[model samples]
Target: MWGEMLGAAIGGVVAVAAAPVVLSAVGFTGSGIAAASIAAKMMSAAAVANGGGVAAGSLVATLQSIGVLGLSTSTNIILGSVGAAIGAAGASEVS
Candidate 1:
């Protein structure tokens, strides 16, 4: 139980801190989605689905927004929660 909590805490922090790097790795950057990247591919798909335009509030758009503007407080909280859940699950499994 203690180990699980500890893992959860660590995972949450790590996930929050690494979000930017991970986003960048996947081609989401401040300068917009990188060419030939997964982000680009997603954008293309989204545009095709939405009649050649990525709709506002869509996943692709939201991600790009985050990439450009950085994560919001609520977003950080959500990320941390997800990370905590994953960490707790992993720690529980290990124990």
Candidate 2:
């Protein structure tokens, strides 16, 4: 249990630190989604799915918002929780 907890804490921290960098690498940036990039492709798909516009709470829109304004506290917490769950699972497997 302790091992899992430690792993979870570390994983959460790492995920929080890495999320923005990862998002940026995939073409999600402060300015906007980059053309000819993965982000653009995702947006295009989302727009098509929503009949010519990305839905307000769609994945692409949420990601773009994160890219521009960064994760909100709730979203940060959710990400950390997911990371924690994965880390705990990994730790348990190792043990």
- Estimated TM-score per prediction? 0.85, 0.80
The 10 consecutive residues of candidate 1 with the worst lDDT sum are: 6-15
Could you give me the TM-score of model 1 versus the true structure? 0.85
User: Model 1 off-target regions past 4 Å?
Assistant: none
Best by lDDT: 1
Misplaced by over 4 Å in model 2 are 49-51
State the lDDT of candidate 2 residue by residue for 1-95, as single tens digits: 99999989988887888899999999999999999999999999988888999999889989999999998899889889888888888888999
In candidate 1, residue 12 scores what lDDT? 99
Q: Tally clashing residue pairs in candidate 2.
A: 0
lDDT (tens digit, per residue) of candidate 1 on 1-95: 99999989998999999999999999999999999999999999999999999999999999999899999999899999999999999999999
